[model samples]
Target chain A: MIHTEQLTKVYPGTDFAAVDCLDLEVGTGEIFGLLGPNGAGKTTTAGMLTTRVIPTSGRALVGGVDVAAQPALAKQVSGIVSQQNTLDRQLNVWENLYFHGRLFGMGATTSRRIADELLEQFQLEKWAQASVYALSGGMAQRLMVARAIFHRPAVLFLDEPTAGLDPQSRLALWEVLGQLNRDGQTIMLTTHYMEEADRLCHRVAIMDHGKILALDTPAALKRGIGADTIVTVRAAADPEQLAAVLARDVAGVERARVADGAVQLDVSGGQRLVQQIVLAAERAGADILDLSITEPTLETVFITLTGRELRD
Target chain B: MAASDVTGDVTTRAVPARIELQLRPVLTASYSALGALLLRDLVVLWKDKWVFVLRTVIQPFLLCFVFLYVFPKIGQGVGGGGGRRGESSFATVLVPGVVGISIMFQGVQSIALNMAQEFGFTREIEDRVQAPCPIWLVAMAKVLSGAAQGALSAVLVLPIAAVVHAAGVHAHLDLRWWIILTLVPLACIAMAGLGLVLGTSFEPRNIGLMFGFIILPITFLGGTYYGWTTLSPVRIGGFHWLQVLVLINPLMYVNEGMRAAFTSSPHMHLYVIYPVMAAFATTFLAIGLRNFRRRVLA
Candidate 1:
């Protein structure tokens, strides 16, 4: 549904390109996540794809139309929910959606009908007659989504759809996105939250410094590290002694490091490794106060590849 | 036989559906989209109907009453044409001037001030620009709405202004029907174009500076209290430099056009008024469009 080849955008008076040579494709009816830290060019890429910002070089196509050559066509196929809330604060919730539909050439009656349905679907029917200024942050974000999809565009581009929302609100928004994808709308979203990407996206791309570091499904990206579990053991004595013993005893230990008075190891079979590592620690006259075996998460994958935490 | 008949019906229905989709009438759809944007703005104004109406009528009404009626009643004369034979009374002379200034200020306040806020912290303009039309059309909608408001202000202010104080002011209002019909819209358009340029040029942070540096000067020197021709005697030895200075002000033509339409006062010649106003409109529109495009892209 969307494709880009070496897409780049460099703002005037800036040295480095905001979006540098990004090669991406989002298939029809799939939720693709562009995961990156703040200022990592995800929003710039989405802006160029939506034709809100002209690309400095490269090509993009949305629904078989070249975006640079035929921006209106691309706009017709894609709806954008920018990072900033673009809801009309002066207008009521229903009026905002109705005006969006009208901009896409729907008649007044049809626009109101579609707006009403979307409002109901987003659970915003109670706020239909309420001005946007009266809405809470989560309600306003949901209204922004409703306004974007009121035209029924084939592809939806959401730039940080869940930023600043509480956990419940983020999960509710993810459910809405999942339902939209199941109903055959292609979705492209950018997010800094690792769990959002893991739970929502069918395919995820990790980007930093205007570059895509990696791309794959959440499970596949995690599995690419080859370690299924992380074993962390708290030590009463020096952690270096326990780390040395674990390094000598555990065969499947891929990496061992001491942090916060705990010997943490990435291993293949965490259950067996935990049993053996605890025995080794007790024999070394070190008390194993606590032990935890965790499944490898996106955070570990990101740290292994980039050598930094996603938030950092 | 029954299955074949159902399949034939479905195929026949699909063929026309494909044809209808193919012939979907592109230009009309685009025009309708533009119209929808225009109507959307108008509807928003309508929803705030009382506020808009009060905003349009109140300021001009107060200015006309205080400056034309109450001030002269308290023995403050506005013009030097009080005792001349063919000259108009102060109220007569000030009527069109008040109307013209009101329209100009209305355009600036409604269009420029509102644009500053939209392009400020709220960034409501972004949603408007996201409409399916070209970016230029979005800017045009702003100008059009401002012009509509200006026109409405002109209509609402004239009658209240005309009948406010009638005792010794024998002001003959020769409302040239043709001039009123043609020039009011032109004046509104010109003022709206100027407003557009001002709106895009001033960032919200420095809007107070814009009024101090630009709007105040334009209002005072815009031939609001006196005719442009009347300023001829205050020139340098052989040059009408004051009149020439006011030429750069778009409100000069609006006031001149009002003079020609409302009273028998000697005013700036029609030939100069028409072309100068047209030139100002074109220049402001070009600059406004360029600035709007640059800002939106940025």
Candidate 2:
């Protein structure tokens, strides 16, 4: 389990805090996700909890050891898979896991046996003797995960776990993480991939600018958008004004705002919705260039909350 | 501990029982992790033992062959001395110097050069530091392994001194047991510490600058071809600036100590050599460990 109380980090020479007054808790058996775009302080949050980056203020406890105060002990309890392929380049595939086991105080025979088992479980036994350079990107990532968990850490922390992988590899990593969680690993990961969060995390916290705007199960978060459908209208100009006018005047429209150069509306139900939309746009002296309707998703929820796309 | 026993504990320990951390438990863990880290490096070295031996011996071997064997036999030619007597004397200086420089090269090449890549953009040192010990201990592992390699290179290079001269161009080694036992290990530690400082001080991109500016200067002026005692003539205003300047070079102490250990050649007194070498070793390790901590954190 991981818990933090107003954990904060303001990198030196910067006036702004990267992670600000964050109070977070991750339960022992849940897969938690911090969903945000780059610089959202998601990685910084993960860094603080993992004790890689010391927090400027506040406290973080991982597996009941204060990470900032007792990093050595915290490290014993936590496993980390960073975004990069951090597999040791010098070691063969098997030695990578074997040494990790050794670093965690496992006996030589225990380390070797567990390493061999991990290689088999991760489907990397064929390359056990091969240098890490021989692995493809996905295989290398899997090997890193296998090494991280070789110590049977209490909590597993992954930072942007699948930022750069082929679709197959990404899915494969997801499956691997899912299996680990099922085996009772306390999992926490930070990612910008909405689908990854939705599919993999039991609880997802939508984060932006170092603050969580919302947190809930993905299903509950999506349902919290308070509408069944999303209608996006791109106009020639003045989309914000058009959105305000539409929100105030249109029936069944729960919320409307300008997002990604368009007026997006969350509508619960609608008859003659397109006709009403066009009439409202014209009345607001806006020319509609494009109009689209999508079923509400976590993305729609995000844009509704932040008034900007996740990538932006 | 059986694999079967651990297999079941894996499920129960997942939540980690509230992490009641006491220093004794963690200290025990740190010792095992440190031992394991060194073991990993030893295993890597053993895997490449052939290449390692070849790399370690090649430079000193050639230095001795060309200067001690070929030049002495080819008469007073390039690197040959004034005559048999001069070449023979130069052989004494060259042989121990070759051993000293070999120790320096092995330390730098093993720890610093490899560290350039480990801390490079790939940051291959990531998982290593994440071991269940203090970050400084991780660096200590590097220094220890590098020192061992330096000692190994010394051991490997010493045989060349005994065997490699032309018949008359003798090194005149005294084999002082007391000095050899104490000084050789001290020299290894000093050179390995210097390697640590260089490797951590330079970024991967500017490693060429380290070689051009730091390593080259350390090698040439490190008293390999001559003795520190012979540098009295290169003085202006009785300053002995070059001699004083090379004093700042840790390799000077190492080469001088090698002479004290191996030959009757004039060396900087062992009195100055021991404390100064220890100071250099401690200073380099302190700076290098600080730099390493800075690089690893924040």
Most accurate candidate by DockQ:
2
For all candidates in order, the CA lDDT equals 0.80, 0.87
lDDT of 2 by residue, A93-128 (tens): 999998898888989899999999999999999999
Which residue pairs in candidate 1 collide? none
Kindly list the per-residue Cα lDDT of model 2 for residues B1-298, writing each as its tens digit: 6998886676466544422233336798899989998999999999899999999989998988988888778774634446767877888888889989998998889889988889986677877889898989998899999989988888889888778878877777877989988988888888888888989999999989999998899899999998999988899997898988898888898999999999987899999999998999899999999999888887
lDDT computed for candidate 1? 0.80
lDDT of 1 at B21: 19
Query: Positional deviation of B43 in candidate 1, in angstroms?
Result: 1.2
The lDDT of model 2 is: 0.87
Best by lDDT: 2
Inter-residue clash pairs, candidate 2: none
Q: Per-prediction TM-score of chain B?
A: 0.86, 0.90
Off by over 4 Å in 1: A231-250, A256-265, A270-293, B1-26, B81-88, B235-241
lDDT (Cα, 0-100) at A255 in candidate 2: 89
Count of backbone collisions within predicted model 2? 0
